[model samples]
Target chain A: MRIELAYFAWVRERMGTPGETVELPPAIADVAALLGWLAARDERGAATFADPHRIRAAIDGALAGPDAPLAGVREVALFPPVTGG
Target chain B: MIRVFVQAAPIDVGAEIDLHDAGGHGASASFIGRVRGDAGLTELFLEHHPAMTEAGLASLAHAAADRWKLGALTLIHRVGSMTPGETIVLVLASSRHRAEALAACEYLIDRLKTDVMLWKRESFADGRIAWVEEREDDRDRAARWE
Candidate 1:
């Protein structure tokens, strides 16, 4: 499936880009699998996605969890925890 | 009514209040977050996943509405670089009584601190910059609503 990956804050800084569209392998089942798959794609991903526990996600536009399915979704966001008033 | 704004413009506090202050609600409460100049802070850079941020704020508004019998609620958070004395965020809530308005306004601000997708990078006057971390205090505050 094809999906747009978005990074925000420090996650974007470490990734060297804000967002990108990429085609993925079919075996990637959910958000957790997608994170692991992307992290193995390159060194940058490996370094930034080193800790899944520290990472948070939003599937499409709603805050999602590890079990969120990526099927038929257009966008996925990854970032650190929020720190705003 | 739920209104969420994530923008680069300054929050017009009075105008925002007037937009929803159509009587009936006997009590209204607001919270403004400003850049603290006294903390050796020079600038604050706010970043977020655009669509998700708004959606998150709307969800927070909905949650607040559900928790309390809110008549009108507004959440406005600014993005981009901001200096000292600038408004960073605003949470305005109104209800027929003071207790609900106060509690809901406080709840919205407290939940927003940890639940939203916004992130802050602080730049000191000495040229040092750092990403603000999630605080234990914020988490504890949010948990109180449970």
Candidate 2:
């Protein structure tokens, strides 16, 4: 599946881009798996996903856990924990 | 009534308060968050998801209204570059009595810290830039509502 991936804050800085559209392998079925695949893809991904525990994800604009399925998700946002207000 | 706005322009607090007062509720409560100038901070930049940020704020406003029998509620958050002392966020809650409005105001601000899809980056006078880390206390405070 092809998905739009968004990076925010430090994640964006590390990834060197704000967002991108990428094709996913069949094995990348969840947020955790997606992170693992990206980490192995290159140095930028490696640095960004080095500490996946600190990262948070939103699948199709709704907060989702690592185990959340990405079967039909069109967009996924990855960022550090929010610090607003 | 509920109003949620996310903008890059400066927040007009007085104007917002005037509008909330027009609602004619017997009691009103508000929370205004300003960018702190601590440690020689120069600027505070807010990063957010274009669609998700507004949706998150609206959800928080709706949750506050449902939890408390509020007559009116307004939530505003500023994005983009901001200097110290500028208002970053504003929350206004009104109800027939004090307790409901006060609790709703507090609840909205508390939940915003952990729930909103907004991130703050700090720029120092010494040319240092860093993203603000989420505080454990913020998570603890949000958990209090649960």
Give the per-residue Cα lDDT of candidate 1 at B142: 95
Prediction 2 TM-score vs. true: 0.98
CA error at residue A78 for candidate 2, angstroms: 0.8
| Candidate 2 lDDT by residue in tens digits, A19-43 | 9999999889999999999999999
- Clashing pairs for model 1 are none
Please state what fraction of the native interface contacts candidate 1 reproduces: 0.91
Q: What is the DockQ (computed on Cα atoms) for candidate 1?
A: 0.80
Model 1 Cα shift for residue B19 (angstroms): 3.2
lDDT of 2 at B25: 79
TM-score, chain A only, candidate 1, equals 0.96
**Cα lDDT for residue B29, candidate 2:** 89
Tell me the tens digit of each residue's lDDT in model 2 across B29-126. 88999999999999999998899999999998998889888889989999999999999999999998999999998899899999999999999999
TM-score of each: 0.91, 0.98
Model 1 has a clash total of: 0
Span of ten consecutive residues with least summed lDDT in model 1 chain B = B17-26
